[model samples]
Target: MSSGDFSLGDFVQRALPLAILGLALIGAPLLIFEPEGLPRMRALSKELAQVKAENVELTRDVAHLRAEVLDLKDNPTAVERIARGKLGLVRKSEVVFQFGKGR
Candidate 1:
């Protein structure tokens, strides 16, 4: 209540919050508007989304492969179909007519 009677505890109590607030105000702009700060955050966010999409695509691919594996394991016809289609296999009595050879 008296002039020039400031106590140490009162000065510290008042100055501490001001110091913290000053640091926050100064640090916020340095982190938000600085070229390497906000841009890096944005770039990382974009990369995270892209990676998530790729992970989804990979998960779908893995599911398709797993289904194919199940088919190949449980079904004999599936293996025969694949062999015939991909390897150009035919039954012993089947005829293969090549209409577009060396054209």
Candidate 2:
């Protein structure tokens, strides 16, 4: 083949690398900077971690509430304590006292 006689194979071999390089240059920045790319993925991962932590905390709170509900259901003393503490309730013939704040 003569030097000037460029065939399809020659064009393909020469242009393929340039095409690949051009695509890389254009795509690399898009991958890094695009809204749906690495940055968004990282943000989503952080949000997922935060959501998972919140879920765990909520799960703990739910368990605590369930246990408290069970305790209030099964334990008569718990009910009495809440009633007396929150409601200032007293039984019949119970004496009551009041005091002002002291200096």
Candidate with maximal lDDT: 2
Q: For candidate 2, which ten residues in a row score worst on lDDT?
A: 1-10
lDDT of 1 by residue, 1-103 (tens): 6877999999999999999999999999998978889998999999999999999999999999999999999999999899899998988999988877675
Q: At residue 59, what lDDT does model 2 achieve?
A: 100
What tens-digit string does per-residue lDDT give for candidate 2 at 1-103? 7799879998999999999999999999988898989889899999999999999999999999999999999999999999999999998899988999999
Off by over 4 Å in 1: 1-3, 7-9, 91-103
Q: How high a TM-score does candidate 2 get? A: 0.67
Best by TM-score: 1
**Ten consecutive residues with minimal summed lDDT in candidate 1?**
94-103
Q: Report how far off residue 40 is in candidate 2 (Å).
A: 1.5
Q: List the residue pairs that clash in candidate 2.
A: none
RMSD of 1: 3.1
